[model samples]
Target: MRLRKPKKEWRHRKQRRVRITAMIRKELDWIVHDKISMFILFFLPIFLIISVGNVEFNIDSRAQDTVVYVIDLDSSEYSLDYIETIRGENFTFTVYDNHENPDLVTMENAEALIPTTELGAYLIIPSNFSETLLENQTAKIDLYIDGINTIEMLVIKYQFISANLLYQVEYQVFNSEVLYIPEYRPEIDRSILENAVPNMIPTILYAVSNMVACQAIVADDPLKRMLLSPTRKGEVIQAKTFAYIFFGALLSLVCMCVLTFGFGIYFISPLDTFLIFWMTTIFGVTFGLFFSSLASSRLQGAQLFLFSFIFQQMLVNNLRIEPIVNYMPIEVIRQNITDIVYRGIPFLSLGNQIALIAGMNLVALGAAWLSLSLKKEVA
Candidate 1:
């Protein structure tokens, strides 16, 4: 009888210990074992290196790829060759022949076209361009560029000067005692509010979508409660995902409408813009869910989002980070989306980006499923 009692007592104590250990584990999970902390510990340093810290993360790295117009007065072969040489990879050039399109050369027409065209710069080849280069010993090309973005203006300026210099070298104009000087008279676009609206749209979308992505799952107490019902955990997660997608689409639409109508932001293709925004929202939602699955609380999810955003901002276009940075969801979104909206590129052309987004969603969904399964086991 004594042996039996002692064995029973020992079994009870062992059971109690097991329960205590499990409880401790749960509490620890709620307190510290979270996605945010994991990233902070393991990946924070990498992100910091890429971002150069907060100081450089939010800097506007957005550059506008625009179109430049040209008016050719000299029909000489030299003038044509110079024009062809000045056409850059960063921008497209459209030559408007004044003789063929006389109505398009008026001051009134130019001023009207300023608002309508996405013209970054304009060039006028003087009538005596070839004559000046060969005989008069002076090549002065007139250029008027949009100076809204100083950096872009500088790029335009350098491209023109470099092209002219190359032309001089190729034609031996400089050696012929001719000064190949290019005159650039820049016109700063004073429509700051109008010009700034397009630049701001992507950042605004990213910020809003990031918040939505960071909290779509973690803050839902109702999702946790749903587990107590007869519903499977996968079903509950599916519902939450559907909600995020729907709400994300709705929110993105609202933002686009406000910008297009209220703020006068010009989107060349509304359908393309809408589709990109919707897809971006979907991407953001998945991003949040993936982290939230690994996170114990809403704050942790937010931290994850912040780390992601900073890494994206700092690492994008930085050759030091290269290939890996190119694969980031935010970078992909910014590149493809801005190309469509700002550069007027075709949406269908982004085959790689489209595939990448789909792949990311699959990965996120898998992560979310695994996380929910683990949570169920713990409960």
Candidate 2:
């Protein structure tokens, strides 16, 4: 009786161990098979970080090259010295001397030139600029900014204030009685939200391509059946690629129209802006395909895409990773587009960007094609 009881107890213990192992294996299988579970566990964190916490990552490297114009209404020696001090290594200034180009120095002219010039902002020195500092100890300056170039406007404003403060410090050190005070008057009233939409276009397109095109082909029942059919795999891949590009282009056009017509976000070169955005759409499509090819499942592909997109944005605009900036495809495209639309730079300047994006697309397409297996006819 004692030997039989020991044998039953061992059997019970063995059954319990088997059940526990099976439960763990079942959970692993579920995590692999369930797309929603995979996204929640892996991809949601990236999305939340990019979308919600992006306020901390709004830095732009391009702001360093921002240019502004200075209209010296008070063409005194003091004003010219002040203007010279402003033309430091940090920013470039286009000086319009009131004495030389008196016709272009009016307040009305400045307002009209705002729309026609590539200058982000312009400063007007009052006629009492030199006299005020030598007598009243206060100099007033007018700052007129293009409502479109928000980033450059802020940078120029900060640099202008810093330059004036430095000048004050130098004078105070030379003679304790001399006081230099500057008052700035802003001409345009605008908000940061006005330019946010145009800036976010690339990220929006990337997310769209990942969800609509890349995941659609693998997750849809009909597409999966086609993948298992006698269709030429290359042709199928081309069709999907074209569809995604078309959809992305359409979305970009719609967003641009809304920005141009509805809200009046300035696009100096409309054709250049449109073409560059279309090229970025191609980049987004290729990036989605690359992620899909590299990942094992649809959810995993989206997770990879989101992760890469966020990292690329940080590398290009938010962070100062110069060595890796040249290697990131979307970063190149975004920088070129920003120059074209915001800085009024010509499209021909984007020759390197065009070549780099083309190379990246070819590599991504080749990888995607190689990853997919075609169904062979059975004997």
Candidate 3:
């Protein structure tokens, strides 16, 4: 019997023939078939830009402004002193004379002209107000706060009352003593401000890394092929993971550019800013790849993505498993990645940023290697 021609046996090899280009084409095709999904993907960055633009964050602890209408039934020095005690830019005051029409502050006017339409709330100082104020008796001050500005109005009112009481005695001795307030020190709070981006970076990186860091086998089928030529499992994993990291890094760079030139993320050196953003990107994408490897299907991968995304959202409110989620690498896995927009970057100073990124990549690559199946399901 004639011997049958031996079937082709494959050996692993690397052909630097732009292997990634083939994959990119496949990804593009996937995008094409689903126009709606592709359209959404194209606009993802802009949507997030507008979405994040509306968000606000604060760190300083201080009182806010409030408006008060003082019905001065007592014009005595004591009553005046009581009013003077509450004297501060934090509160806006309008002293209504007893002879003046109460209509301006009447139930009718209060309903029509109070805080809802004005600066916030109004307080009434009844007749003999100064005599009782000096007597150390509980003198009543009726207040009407616009319910529309309820939270803001309440905060202002509480501060106004508390401050007025504290300084009431002080005014008795020093009529015009100006209290000194220390200026805010950015240098002292550099660490806190610098590390704030970690809260957002983890989640942001996760979404972008998926564009490149998907682990899968490439097979050659005439109708559908992910292979340009013979591609090894190890090579495929390496290329994909590296590309994923690159995508995150690119996204971070893009955001950094917009924040600096477009939205003004910071007021510092371009080099320094770039370094900080780069470090943040590394932490995010590396964590994303790690999560990707653990998943069994695209659905599982998306589930992982949602978990990271939610975790990032929680970080803005300081609600998460870790108190330091704001600065974690995993946070980049969400679209919520931050880049020292309001503060500085910590754990990723110049050299440390580089080291951390390199370290993370190493960890991700190692994980991918361990999980890659030479005898994969597709081949």
Flag regions of model 1 displaced more than 4 Å: 1-200, 317-320, 342-344, 376-379
- Write one digit per residue (lDDT tens) for candidate 1, span 1-379: 3544345442465654544444334433432444653343224323432333232223323323455556778878888777667654433345554455677664455555654446667677888998987774777777887766677677667767677777777666665465645664554332343444334445545555555556645765565654564445555456556655665566567766655565456777878888787787677667677777767787787898888766666776454386787787667777677668756787778988888888988888788878868874311
The prediction achieving the highest TM-score against the true structure is 3
- Against the unseen true structure, what C-alpha lDDT does each candidate score? 0.62, 0.61, 0.50
Reference-based TM-score of each model: 0.48, 0.49, 0.57
> How many residue pairs clash per model?
0, 0, 25
Clashes of 2: 0
Global Cα RMSD, each model: 16.3, 19.1, 7.6
lDDT (Cα, 0-100) at 63 in candidate 2: 52
Error of 2 at 72 (Å): 42
Q: Write out the backbone clash pairs for model 1.
A: none
Q: Which of 2 and 3 is the better model by TM-score?
A: 3
Between candidates 1 and 2, the TM-score winner: 2
Error of 2 at 208 (Å): 2.8
- Rank all candidate structures by their TM-score, best first, as comma-separated numbers: 3, 2, 1
